[model samples]
Target: MTTAPGPAYRSAPTTFGAVARHGRAWLPVIGLTALASSAVSLALPSVLGHSVDAIVAGSGYGRWFTIAAVLIGVGVLCSLIDAFAGTACVAGTTAWLRHGLVSQVVRGGAEGSREFDSGDLVSRVSGNASDAAQAGPAAVTTVAATAPPIGSLVLLALIDPWLAVAFFGGVILVVGVLFVFARRTAEISLSYQQTQGRISALLTEAVTGLRTIASAGTTTREERRILGFLPELHRHGLETWKVLARSGAQAAIVGPLVLVAVLAVGGLQLVDGRITPGELFAASQYAVLGAGLGSLTGVIGEIARARAGIQRAAEVFAIDKVAHGLLPLPPGPGRLTFDGVTVVADDAVLLENIHLELPGGATIAVVGPSGAGKSVLASLAARLRDPSIGQVLLDGVPLPALNHHALRTAVGCAFERPTLVGTTVGDAISHDAIGPVRTLAAARATHAHDFVRRLPDGYFTPLPKAPMSGGERQRLGLARAWPASRLLVLDDATSSLDTATELQISKTLTEDRYRRTRLIVTHRTATAARADLVVWLDGGRVRGVGSHQDLWQDASYREVFG
Candidate 1:
């Protein structure tokens, strides 16, 4: 399911300085290359002015012309280096941010990360992350960009103090225009990104439920609703260009005034013989370099976008990660206990005051009507989510107190809709802590070995090339979970299978020699009947806990299966 961004979406603030700091070793490369580019730019004007003087004097001018050409070549080479370094820096930082975001989301787990929509998280990771990586390179390059203008001012002053004074006036106005642009673009870009994320979320939700929409004949309504934010996105996009255009207009008016002022002042100095023709030409070149602030509008805009990206990424970073203790689990059968466990979301209690204990090495079926918190109890049994009010313990050790490896190695879970992620069908079952040793046995146990062997390459077949029905995928999920030695939780994991396959799999679960605790959340009366004990739940409270036959004697308990 997808959700719209609410007021608490961006609760944490991300700073530009913080983002730039992430560049680490890459920052120095970008800075050095950009400074080299600036140095070459500053040297070129002087070399060209000297070449003009040598030509006018009718002396040998080849040396000066060659020097000017070399300077230009050096400038181009430095620019190329700067570009390459900037690209590498952005690439590295994007990977870093993506890794951090993904790790954070995974650490939070499904229940903890429920506040975010899948599409929105995708947009942030792929799109906003790239934009955020620009912070380091953009900051370094923008700073280096200042060198040329400042160098021009110094050169203009040496040519004639009046030219420096004239260029400085335009610099002031250029700075003002840039300041306004940076501030305005930051606000508008953030809004644009938010709207874009919203559209992505709605589109993802629609795609996920595409079949429902088609069957209900509501595709038109869905399309309209998904695109509802387009107008707002369009308006924000237009404003970004409007801001750029307005700044360019201001620069156009102010830029020429500075160049004209320098030339006008330098011409008088030349007429008075206070400065040479070459010096006046040099002054004009300096004026052009110093007043070319309009050219940097694009760079400034990128910096603004980077800021917005950092802010958006901070939202994910702010999510509280599931923390585990350093202690390991001790040897015992998976004796599970729920002490006054409760789970509440948005003031609605899903599970309330669940205080019960299930002995080790028992196959227990958690049976209840829909919304009776059956799945919730199963999740608690596996410690996938911590109880809001009380702690869940395994073998008398609090689940949260155990370290990550200790807990994960002990429990395995299979879900109704399992996503098999690996390069090959065999690889997915062998993925995670399950390992390859049990892959074959687990497959055979779940009755998936035959269909898997029929594939073109058998276990070696790639996941994309190996097509599977819903039940087949579920069996693979069970195979993946089979390596657990302490507890196994099947949350409607076999629901897609036919009754015969389901019955066969159920027998394997009960009669297996491993003797580990098995918690099965199922709606089928057959599954409950096969369990050593049935945890009959109604309205989130335990109605009874005993043999299935004993609970079946109650008419209300029979209606739960109905």
Candidate 2:
């Protein structure tokens, strides 16, 4: 199967549209509420203009008082509506964005697509998604809020076109300034976010390898490397703020200047009888409304940043590829075959032109020197990685064609470095399908049962909260895997165990009681001695395949053994 494309190439709308469809009901509600709120806010200035006109006309005191009271009431009502709508929009968008991001991460899978970087994926899912969540509601609300001011501008133009022209002109200038600065702000913000992700990944790697760093006396140097990224992050933040600050100053200074200019021109018009006092007052109020609209420049900047975040999030959701096998295997007790298979990675052939067959209820040992690709060969048989050429089959069917989950269920692997789950030893082995057999059974097989039983809670004991020795962890890892999979693959799994323990486990696995195919990848001559067949690999090719004694008699095999 072809590998999936990376996150960068996928269409953003596919992801955004999916989120919107899922959140349609709430999104519309937020938009409608915001529209209503903006309408109410727009009414306030109109009502105030009416009240001022009434006072100027020498209307009854009670009439002017009533208009003022109505304006105040409308202002209060709009504030409440704005608060409620803002809260709903923010809460709904946050929930949707978080949910969508999580779904994307899950579907992307743990092994990840070859094209996507794990560090970048982490940052997009965790940090960029958060930024989108925080910004979505405000951005939606701002767009909604723009509508009423636009409508009011139309109404103002009908009242007096010259004043309307001034309002539009001022808005254009402010918007132009905002757009220019917004681009710079967005670029810097994206850089900062990407850098932060890289820093986090570096820290995670350092922490996970703390022992190695400490042992090598390289902790200080590693720390300094991490610290070095901070200056770059700081510089990006500073640059973004500088651009934003300059844009904000321009908006602040220009908005009031436009308002003052409009007011002065309107006053001159009123004196010249081109309009009434009430008309001039209304026009000035409209100018202020336009100024309020201009303030959305700051909101526009926020939106630019949010758009960058959305793009980042979109990149993560784009990765649709995962490693998969190209063929299927027929169902039966696990019978494995390697048909002229070769494995290559990083332009180096690790396993080449190897042919082998492992029948059900049989044990085979794969013997090779280090870097001979014995483990790589075993992993291919289990379909961990596809063969560079040729095919591996299970039960007469190609391995890749088997359903991935089913294939994994049929095959279990115990790595050279074992991995255990859960804290308590009993917790680790309690539910293993092999039996309710205590941790001791598994530990004893690998000679870990004794040391574990001596701990405070014995089989019920928990591992230390801190890190443990590699060998101890590996033993526990094997104990966990041994009982879980039907077709067991032990890739140097017993390397940590003493010779006696390794022999015991090997003997137990060889018995009819196990009744499973076992592929042991090891360097131990004793392990090969116990196998029904020994496949010797050398320089990525099959050097020999036969009983250990048969290979021992061959000149090539004897030379290596000697």
Question: TM-score for each prediction?
Answer: 0.92, 0.84
Give the Cα error of residue 171 in candidate 1, in Å: 1.3
RMSD of each: 4.3, 4.3
lDDT, candidates in the order shown: 0.87, 0.69
Off by over 4 Å in 2: 1-22, 58-121, 134-139, 320-331, 344-349, 423-467, 553-562
Error of 2 at 62 (Å): 5.4
lDDT tens per residue, model 2, 1-562: 2221112223245343343344345556666666766665666566666666777777754665676677567657756765675566556665666676666665445433445555666676666765665464555667786775586578677767777777777877766776787678778878888788788778777877898999999988999987889999999888887987888888788788768877877777777888777677777777777666656656666665566677777766675433444444454667788887877677888887777877776788888777888888877866666676788777776765666665666776777775466667656654444554644566666556756766777766665543356566666766665653457788888777776666777788787375778889977778888888888888998887889988887777765545
Q: Show the lowest summed lDDT stretch of 10 residues, model 2.
A: 1-10
RMSD of 2: 4.3
**Which prediction has the highest lDDT against the true structure?**
1
True-vs-predicted CA distance for residue 186, candidate 1, Å: 1.1
